[model samples]
Target: MKKKIWVNIAFQVGALVLALLSTTLLLLAAGAPPFQAYAAILKGAFGSAGSLETLLITWSPLLLTTAGVLITFSAGLWNIGVEGQMAMGAIFTTWMLRLLQETSLPPALTIVLGILAGIVGGALWAGLAGALKTFGGVNEIFGGLGLNFVSTALTIYLVFGPWKRPGVGSMSGTEPFDRSLWLPTLPDTELSLWSLTLSLLALVIIIVLLRGTHFGLRLKAVGKNPKSAFLMGVPTWQYSMLAFLLCGALVGLAGAIQVTGVYHRLLPNISSGYGFLGLLVSMLVNYQAVWVAPVAFFFAAVNVGSIQLQLMYKLDSSFSGVMQSLLVLLVLLGEGARQRFLRKH
Candidate 1:
C-alpha cells in the first residue's frame, strides 16, 4: 500500500513536470519568453471577474465529466462515450424544451423536465454499450466509440431535418429556447452556482457510493479481478452496466448544465473536448474521487490559460493539447517505472 501510494504521487509529479516542459517548449518555439507566456495565461484565466467567469465556465463540464468517468473506471470499465453522451443529453433537452414550449407548465418545472430528458438521453445511449458488453460480447471502448460517431451524425441530421431552425447548422441551434427555461447565472459572474453545485453534489455522491457502499465494493472487486469476483458470486456484468448507467446520468447532467447555463443552445462542438480532458484529469488524479476536484480546477486553469497564451503570445492553442498528452504519457510511464522499482526492492 505504501509503495502504491508513492508510485501514484510520483506519477502526478511527473505529469506536472511534463506539462511545464511542454509549455516551455511552446514558448521557445514561438520565440517568446516562457515565463511571460505563463504569466499571461495566469492573468487571462483569473485576473478579473470576467476571466474567472470564463474559467468557471470551462471548469463545469470537465468537473462533471470526470466524475462520470470515475463510475465506470471504479468498476474496471472503460467508458469513452462521454462525448456522445453529452451531445445526446443536450439534444434531448433541446427537443424536450421545444416540445413543451406550448405547455402551461411552470418555468421551473420545464427546466426540470429538460434536465430529466438529458439524463434519460445519456443513459439510453450509454446503456446500449453496457447491454452490448453484457450480451453481445462487444467491448465497451469500441462500442462507445462507434456510437459517438452515430450520435454526432444524428445531431447534425436533427438540426438539418425536422428540428432545423430557420438557418440550419447555425449557432442558435434548432431554435432559441424560451428565456424561462434558461438556467439562471450569477450576477457577479457568468458562472452558475447552481450548476457548479450540481458538480459538487456529484463528486460527493460518487465518493460516498464508491468508497462506502456494497455496490462500490463489488465494483472494486470486479476491477481488481473479475474472474475471482465472479467466483465469489459477484455479478460483474450487472455491476458494469450499473456503472455505465451512472456514468451516463452524470455526463448527461453536465451536458444539460452547459446548455442551460452557458451556451443556451446546442453547438456541434459543444463538448469541446472537455470529455477527453476530464479523462486526463481522472488519470492524473490516480482515480481518487476526492483528488479529481483539485486536478480538474488545475486543468481548467491551464485550458483557460492557453486561450490567453494564444491571444497574448501569438502561439497556437494546440500547445495545451501537446502539454496534456505529454503529461498523460509521462505519468503513465512513471507509474510503470515506480511499480518496477517496487518489484525489484
Candidate 2:
C-alpha cells in the first residue's frame, strides 16, 4: 500500500512537471521569457494585497462551482447544463432583487431572498435536465447542452427585452442595483466575506457528505453500476435527480455571489465559464471532494495571475487556460499510464 501510494505521488509529480515543461515550450514559442512570465504570474497573483483580494474573489465562486460539480460527478452525471443553471440563478437573483429593491423590506432580507431565489432557479433548470434523462430517455449530456442554450437565450432576451436598462438595452446588462442590496465586502475590495464564508461552508459540507455518508456510498455504487445498484434496491433515478438538484443549488450560490458580491448586476456571460472550469477541476482531481478546494484555488490564482501576461508580454490571458488544459490532459494520461504499469507489473 505504501509503495502504491508512492507510485501515485510520483506519477502526479511527473504529470505536473510535464505540464510545466509543455507550458514553458509554448511560452518560448510565443517569444516570451518562460521564467519571467511565470514570475510575473506568481507576482500578479500574490504581489499585493489587492491582487490577493482579487484572487479570493475569484476563488469564492470557483469553490462553489467545484463543490457543486463534485456531487454530479459522483453520481455519474455529466451535467453540462451547469452553465445554464448558473445563468438561471443569476437571472432569478437579479429578478428578485429588482422586485424587492423598492419594497419596504430591509435590504439584508431582500438579498437573502434573492439568493434563495437563485438557488431555486438553478434547481429548476437542473431538474429539467434530470427529468429528461430519467423519464424521456434523453442522455444527460445532450439534455444539459440543449438546456444551456435555452438558458443563454433566455438571459439574452431578458437583458435585451423586459429587463432592459432605461432607454435602450445594451449587452452590459441591466441597471445596477442600489448599494444597499449589494453583499457586504471588505473595505476597498470586491471580496465579500459573506460570499467567501458561504463558499467555504459549502465546500466543507460537501466534503463531509461525500466522505462519511451512506448516501455517498450508494451514490458511488450507482455511478459505478446503475443496474447493480438498482438490484441492490437503491433508487438510482431518484438519487440521480437529487444529485442534480444539490449540484445546481451549490452552483446557483456561485451565480448569486457573482451578482450580489461581484458584478452587482445581471450581465451576459455571468457564469464566466466557471461551470466549464469547474468540470475541468473535477476531472483533474478525479472527482475527489478533498482536492476540490485547493485545485479550484490554484485555477483561480492562475486566472488572476495571467492578467499580468497580457499586460507585460502582450500575451493573451488565455495562456493560463492553455496551461490548465495541458495540466488536466497530462494528469489524466499519467493516471492511465500508472494503471497500465501496475497491471503489467
TM-score of each: 0.94, 0.98
Which lDDT tens digits does candidate 1 get at residues 242-328?
889988988888888877878777766666787778888888777999888887987888888888877877788877777777777
TM-score of model 2 relative to the true fold?
0.98
> How much is the lDDT of residue 334 in candidate 1?
77
Writing each residue's lDDT as its tens digit, candidate 2 over 1-345 gives: 898899999999999999999999999999999999999999999999999999999999889888888899999999999999999899999999999998899999999999999999888899999999999999999999999999899988998899999999999998999999999988877788999999999999999889899998888888889999999999999999999999999988889989998999999889988999999999999999999889998999999999999999999999989999999999999999999988795
On the 0 to 100 scale, the lDDT of residue 48 in model 2 is 98
lDDT of each: 0.83, 0.93
Tell me the spans in candidate 1 whose CA falls farther than 4 Å from its real position. Answer: 1-15
Candidate 1: count of backbone clashes, pairs at least 3 residues apart or interchain: 0
Candidate of highest TM-score = 2
At residue 210, give the lDDT of candidate 2. 90
- Scored against the true structure, residue 308 in model 2 reaches a CA lDDT of 99
Per-residue lDDT for 190 in model 2?
77
Q: List candidate 2 stretches off by more than 4 Å.
A: none
